[model samples]
Each structure stands twice: as C-alpha cells, then as structure tokens.
Target chain A: MGINSVTTMSPGVGAKLRRMHPLPIRIMHWVNAVAMFIMIGSGWKIYNDEVIFGWLHFPEFLTIGKWAQHGLQWHFLGMWIIFFNGLAYLTYGFATGRFRRMLLPIAWRDVVATIKDSLRLKLSHDDETKYNAVQKLLYIGVLLAGVMIVLSGMAIWKPVQFSELYFLFGDFQTARLIHFFCMAAIVGFVIVHIALAILVPKTLVAMVAGGPIVSDADQSGARHMNETGNHP
Target chain B: MSKPPSRSIFRPSGKIDSSILQADPKLLYEIDRRKVIRGAVSLGALSFLTGCNVSEVDQVQSALRAVSTWNDLAQSVIFRPNHLAPTYPESRVVKPPRFNAHYNIEDVQPVDVNGWKLELSGLIADKRPWRASDIYALPEQEMIIKHICIEGWDYIGQWSGVNLKTFLERIGADLSAKYVAFKCADDYTESLDMASALHPQTMLATKYAKELMADPFGFPLRLRTATKIGFKNAKWITALEVTNNRPQTYYEKEGFNWFSGM
Candidate 1:
C-alpha cells in the first residue's frame, strides 16, 4: 500500500510507467482553465450591463471588460476558445477511454458514504491517481454544467436561428437564467476545486506536472477491479 | 522595476491648492487625474506582464474583429431564407412598446407626414421618391414577434406595415444586391444583408400595437425585422439604398456588430 511498494522500478523505469495525468489531458486542462477564467470574467461584465436580479451587480475590478461592448468582444473570444477546447477535451476523453478509466460507475451508496466521510473530515487522499466518489461526482457535475452553459449561450446568441435550443429552455429569458445558473455552478465548482487543491497541494502539481506513476500491471489491475465491481 | 518619478504637480493627497487652480483654470478639468494615472500605470503593467507591445494589442483586436466578421459569415450561411423568427400571441404584445435610441425620447424630432418622402437610390431600377401616403397604400403585413435588444432585454411587439420584400419588388429594387441600407430621419443609419432584407417577416413597419407608431417610436416607417436585434431595426426611416457595397451603420461605427442577428 506504500508509494515505494506500488512502483518497485528504478527512476528510468518509472519514467516509462503511465503518468497520473497524460500530456494531452494536462494541456487540455490548463487551456480550459484559462478559457474558463476569461469566459467567467467577461460573462459577469455582460450580466452587469443588464442584471437578471436587479439588486446584484458584479464589481468592475472583478470583470474583464471596461464596457458592455468590450465585455462582449472578450466574451466572444473566450467562447470560441472554450468551445473548441471543450470539443477537443470531450473527444479525447471518450476516444482514449479516459472518461471510463477516471470517471464512471457512480453508485449512490458510495456517493452517500463519501459525502458522510467528507462531512466528518475523514475522507482519504491516499490515492492521488484515482478520484474518490465525491471528486467523480463534482467532475461530472462541472462537466455537465460546462456543456449546459455552452448550449444555453448558443440559445441566447441565436434564438431565431437556433430556435429549437431556445424553446428547449422555454424562452429567451429562461435561457439567459439557465446560462447564469450554469455559470454560478461552474464558479462554485472552481472555488471548491481550488480550495481542495490548496489543501492537498500535490493534486495541483499532479495536474500541472504529472504526479505518481502507475505501472502497466497496476493500471490493468485497477481496470480489472473496476470491471468486476470490486473497486476499493 | 524602478518606480517612475511622479509627474503630477498636485500633492500626494491629490489635494489642489486654490492658488494653483487659479494659476491654470484647465487644471480644474483634470478631475479624473487619479483615474488617468491608474489607467496609464495599468496599461504599462499589462503590457509588461504579458510581454505585448501596442502593436500586439492592435493585432489582438484585429484578430477578434476578424472572428466577429467570420461569425457574420457563418450566421449568413446558416440563415435560412425561409426560416421565420418566433411569433407570440396577441395578448403578449406590450402596449406602448419600450422606446430605445441613441438619444433621449425628449430629443426625438417628429417628421411632418406631408413633407416626409421615402427616397430611393443605389441598385434600384426606379429612383423615384415615394410619399408617406404611397407607403400606406401598399399591402400591409402584421407580426407579433419578440423584439430582442443586444443589451439582453426583450419584449413582444406587434408591428404592422408593408413587407420589405414586397415593397422592394414594387420599387423595382435589384433583389440580387448584397445590402439594403437605411437612412433614418434622426441621422441614424442601419443596413441588412440581402437575405435578411428579403425575409418574409422583415417589414417597413409604420404602426405598433394597432396604432400609428408615435414620433419617439419610429413614426412614418421603420425597418422591423424579427431576425435581427432591436438596433438593426432602424426607426424613422427616410431613405432606402440597395447596393453591393456594405453601408456603415451608426452603431457599427461605434463597434457594435453589423449583422447583429438574433
């Protein structure tokens, strides 16, 4: 169960072991992080121009653009980046079986247990390579939110041309509300995500520079356990 | 980095002596001195932090504009000529439709109906001017469509007038032209792509909510296209030009997207 026991190989051989995060995943993650930041900042500026809730207005310093039009320019730029980057990430995730390997089979029982342990501050961070039930749920939730934000954005952008999507969210006003909530969900997720990363700093480093490596046998063994419904 | 020397003659507290203010009255106009200084510093810091020059900033802006232009092209390609903007029930129409313009409602100059003439030019076969009476004589089409503003507000408006495509055909306009540009009485100008100009829902709207549109709400005639954002719907239209050349609109000149379709 020790780190040394998991990898009995030398440094050179350790280099050959599967990385906790592959190069492509790491690149996509960072690119998405920048895109998300730009999108959120500019989106806030756009929202402030005409707020849904009259009482709420985001501060100017926290926003990306100096004016509403300027915010629109930044928002559009961020939109293109996030759209293409997200498409690439999804493609890579499904094609490479990354989704199956990293995030799958969320049992309600396990999720409830994970939540209970998390509340008690007894949740383990022993396996940096694998995501716990809570982590899996969060990742999946944020991913869904990302997709919803984009779709709702499209609905808002072209309510006439993309009328199907517009009606899917009921109306133009409702679509805007949906887009706003999706953004809120993403911001919340990012706050928690960053806080957790700070608590367990290695997770942050793992995303940036690949963390502990798993040997071929260990990876396949983990996959076998996943398939046989014996995941620890 | 070494701190730059202070350029302001004002005190560190930003307090100006009355004698200094009297010495140069122009100093009184520098009320945003702090803001200007902060802006300049931030601009410098931004360029330094990003390792970007003024030229690079310009390059980034041009690139974004290019993307916006590309979006315009993409929208046109996907724009179904026959596809209609969603319509609403008659009950949903807002009475006394919200007024929006570059200037205030009090500043809206009412055009004399008798003196008003719809001038025609550009690629049209007939360049003759039509009076307001002539426009009213044309077959009127009515629509209760959502008027969406770029600022994200929307309202159901019941607009009724001559269908633009029908009017264009009657006026002997070259429908093949790339653009249909409008010149308004209020000095506001707007243009639409040929496809949008020919849309069934696009109209030379003269009435709102079953009444002649008020002066502040584009009286006489206006371009009311459901497919475009509210700004693209020019009010108080005085002239129509059919041309291959793209006409620069008032808002477009101010950096708003030209083809601001819904």
Candidate 2:
C-alpha cells in the first residue's frame, strides 16, 4: 500500500485482470503511432523547400521543385488514418468507463500526492497505476496539441472557408508556421514518453500482456498501454 | 515449463481442441479468454471502422467542383445551389475598401494613361494597337455581377465594359493564337486559353456599379472575367497581346497555379 512496501504478487496475478482497452482502441493506438511518425518524417523533408526558409539554403529533394506540395499530400493522406483512429479511441473511451480511469483524476488529493511522490522518485509500482501529476499534465497537453494540429491544419488548408481562422493566424504563411510547430511539439513529447517506457519494464509488459505485475498491489489493475498511443 | 500453444483464432473450432491440451493451463486460460474477447472485438471493430468514415477531406475539395460541373451540363436543373457565391446589395458596399493584393504595380513605372495603347501582338499575321478611347467607343454592355474573391469574400456591383470577343474579331486574330495574353501596366501579366477568353461573360470592365470604376479596383480599364477566381481579373491594364501559348503572371511566377479557371 505504501511506497517502500510493494509486496510482490504471484506470477499468475498479472494475467488475470480484465483489459481496460477493447481491441479497437489497441489497434487504433498503434496505427496512429505509425502514421504520425511517417507524417512527421516526410513533413520535415518537404518543409525544407519552403520559401520562408529558403534563405538558409536548406538541402532537400534536390531535383524536386515543390517538395512542400508532396509533403502536403502525404500529410493529408496520413490525416485520414489519424482522424479515424482518434475518433474510435474517443468513442470507446466515453462508451466504456475507461475514460474516467485514465483521463479524470480520482481527486485533487491524489493529484497532489502524485506530484509529491514523483518529485522524489519515491513512487511505488502501484503509484504508477494512477497517472502521476506530470504524466496527467503531459497526457492532457498532447491531446490539446492534437486538437491544435487539426484546427491549424484546417486554417491553412481551407483559408477561404474559415476566414476568421486566417485572421487568427494573420495569414496562410503564419498558419503554416503554427501547424509545423505543433507537430514538432507532439514528436518531442512522444520521444520523451518512449524513453520513460523503456525506463520502466513493467509499464511496457502491462501494455503488451494486458496486465501488469502490480495486479494485486493496485486498484485500477489495468496498466496504461495507450498513454503515448504507440503500442501495437 | 512449456509455452502456450498458438493456433489460428479464426480457424474452425475443431482445430482448437487439439492445440488447447498441449499448453500451460495459466497461459492457455489467458489465450482462450483473449480469443473469445478478440472475436467479439473484431465484430464490434468492423462496425465501428465502417462508421468512422471521416469524409470531410473529400467533401471540401470536390463538392463545389462537382456541383459546378453538374450545373454546366444539366442546364435545365431548377434547384438553387447552396455554394453559389452570394450577391451583395448596393447599400452594403464599402466605400474605399482596402486593396487585397498589390504586386508588380508598386515597383513599376506608371504607364501614361494618355499615350497608353494596347498592342495586339504575338503569333499574329497583323500587329495592331488600340487606344483607350478607341476601345471605349466600341459597343459596350453593362451587368451588375458578383466578383467572387478566392479569399471567400465577394461583392456584387455594376460592371460596364466592351466584350473581348468583339475586339478579337476586329483584329482578325490569327488562327494559331490559341491564347489571349494581357500585359498589365504594373509588370503583371496573365493569359487564358482562347475558349475562356471568348466566353460571353468575360469583359474588360471600364465602369463599376454604374459609376466610373474606382482606381483601387482597376480603374479606367480592367478585365472582369467571370467563372474564374477574382485574382484572374488583373487590374490596371496597359497592353493586350493575343498568342497561341501560355503566359505567366506575377503570382503565377511565384509558385501559384497557372490556370486558376473554375
């Protein structure tokens, strides 16, 4: 129950818990992860040809004139996958009570305790069951970032339909700048998340096997798999 | 301890029994539960995946194009289209509205309105020049039509101008001239295929809203071509050259589409 007293449960306990995610959520999470990575990589190569950065003489696909257009094509195609995947995950989260488990905090007291324990690296395996304050913050940040990417992408893509959005970003060029920056933020966050997963083996196993070693030591029982939404 | 036996979940139930007994009980129990869970999940997922058809991308790009093309063909269809650009009332007209896009005009030397002449040259048997007054004396038509900006805003106003078709006929344009290229006073140039240039609605406007055209809106003379985005209507005319090939404009030179016709 406490930080120092993480009683090791039997080997079979990790295999018995009911999975928090249905299969749909799991598939969507992994598919979206792959799509987002490809989008970012291809996006970078395409972004190099932009006039805004032309002064840097950034080398890109040397023979191609409009690398940006091709980048846009890939980004647009990848968008379909990410959009549907996200929609499925959100519907499942709301339909099942799982949204509250990972999304809504148990209480502010738990949040405060999480921050305190995380600050000292004294959190037990059970403590990770409920997201730590930092983890919660990052999770919320990434979701909001996703929304920003969608909105800004639309603003740039269909500036005519959303005139006010053009006013918000000042112009097409400005909207494009913001969209690119938001994508970079998401990529950076994902890298940090993967590093953290590798740092904790049980977190990885729980996501892959559908249950964590802390089965007896925790209340939620289900380990967080789709945190960064990278699991297959 | 042996690893749990793996069998195709979708295979007939008969194949599963033989594979079931040769596995660890704990691992087998988890696998059995997973299989049943996955089968139910696959069904639900199939339905959900079908429901999750986010067609916004397809809708936004092709919907208007499809509607316009349909109207062009089915001329008898009576349904008023929704995406048609709105017509504005005269009372709502903004006096001295800000100019939208300024290009080569700002950097170029001004053309003398008095001495200015439109030179009809390029792949033509005869090169002729027409004065502004000469063009003004030709048969004129007036129509209060909407100028729809590609930026999603539009203004309906009166436009009085000579038909481009009349001028081309007078010049006896060469048969090989497949395009009509306009050379602007501001170093901006634009070209259109012979088909678009000869459209009855396309006019080189001289007046706006029953009054002399405002300077900011291509005063004295400008092309008021319909069926294309607003940007195609280049302002502040200086020369018009009929040609058999494509020409470029300021924006087009800077990576914009060459043919912006609707």
Q: Which tens-of-lDDT digit does each residue in B29-142 have in candidate 1?
A: 867889999999999987776555656646556555676788788789889889888898999999899999978889999999989999999999989999988888899999
TM-score of 1: 0.82
Model 1, span A195-220: residue lDDT tens: 99999999999898866665333432
> Candidate 2: which docking quality band?
incorrect
Per-model clash counts, in order, read 0, 1
Over B72-115, each residue of candidate 2 has an lDDT whose tens digit, in order, gives 23321321222222234667555443355554435445445687
Candidate 2 positional error at B15, Å: 38
Docking class of 1: acceptable
Any runs in candidate 1 off by more than 4 Å, and if so which? A1-17, A215-232, B1-60
**C-alpha lDDT of all candidate models, in order:** 0.85, 0.61
For candidate 2, write residues A93-169 as lDDT tens digits: 67755656576665677777877987797646554456665676788788878878877876654443344564688
Instruction: Mark the regions of model 2 whose C-alpha exceeds 4 Å error after superposition.
Output: A1-17, A45-47, A50-66, A106-129, A164-174, A205-232, B1-262
- Residue A142, model 2: lDDT of 87
The best candidate in terms of lDDT: 1
Report the CA-based lDDT of candidate 2 relative to the real structure.
0.61
Q: Chain A structural similarity (TM-score) per candidate?
A: 0.85, 0.69
